[model samples]
Target: MYQLLKQIVTTGIVTEPAPHADSALRQLEQRLSETILKHLGRALAIRHVDAGSCNGCELEIHATNSPYYNLEALGIKFVASPRHADLLLVTGPVSRNMEQALRRTYDATPEPKLVVAIGDCGCTGGVFGESYASCGRVANVIPVDVAVPGCPPPPTAIMQGILTAISARRS
Candidate 1:
């Protein structure tokens, strides 16, 4: 049971429920939403790197930007270089070839930055665990702050991951 709760974890790994659905919590949620909107007012600049994916996961990451689930509403935007990014969005199994690049990206991002590993392959190595060419997971290369799982999670879920990270820091 201890390992089950501590070592073994599901999809995202962390969750927090609002204290209530009543008036005060509702009001607080509204305030939180507004504050998050304000803090995230400027689109969160992000840098995305593919460690060694089969591309199935990358497809889903791209879908987050499609018209329907558009991540822009949360004021998140993908940037090119890690230096300018507030978040590092990593995907795929950790490939030996890209190991250095992943570290370089993480190094380039300034302090207080986050790494959101998207997909089970990126998080726990998923189907590609312990391969000759893979390090297995993203955390093996770079420390992960938040993990958004699925083969590739929906854009809304990605947003939730970001929000949760922000909320945890604030609290």
Candidate 2:
């Protein structure tokens, strides 16, 4: 135990440096903050729907909520109900079983809502493409304002997609 303490003392504080203020994430957060204020005039509530994902995209989305990303600080947050959401983040390719549900979710969201298709499966249907059970891209069933393409897009890219959807609402 004494040796461990000595080693700890020698090592000192070993922690990752704090992210730079001008980093891409910080920049995106700043833009989101401004857009939320100017466009929505309040916090942006996001509702994430998984049509038929393998959970890869969900994992990446989860990363955005970490301290490094600080999604809540940008006034953008995930919600459980579509009724309370200002934006919808849909993941994975649309499946036959989930197609109706996804449509209902879209319909439930109030007018002036924005939709962002996340991941390659959501954007282009990926390897699944259109099949007997798969409905292809998100736009195939409902309107999509922005599409973030990646098998499981990085959190930063996902953040950018959210920003892009918000910016589109402004124009």
Can you give the TM-score per candidate against the true fold?
A: 0.73, 0.77
lDDT of 2 by residue, 85-123 (tens): 988899999999999999999999997677888999998
Each model's lDDT comes to 0.70, 0.79
Candidate 1 RMSD computed on C-alpha atoms after optimal superposition onto the true structure? 14.4
Error in Å for residue 161 of model 1 = 1.7
Cα lDDT of model 1 by residue, 1-171, tens digit: 976776555433333322111121110122234455456446677788998888877787786777565666557788878898877888898899899989988998986576778788987899889777899888888877677777777656666665554452232
Q: Name the best candidate (by lDDT).
A: 2
RMSD, every candidate, angstroms? 14.4, 6.6
lDDT, candidate 2, equals: 0.79
Q: What stretches of model 2 exceed 4 Å from their correct place?
A: 1-42, 168-171
Which pairs in model 1 have colliding backbones? none
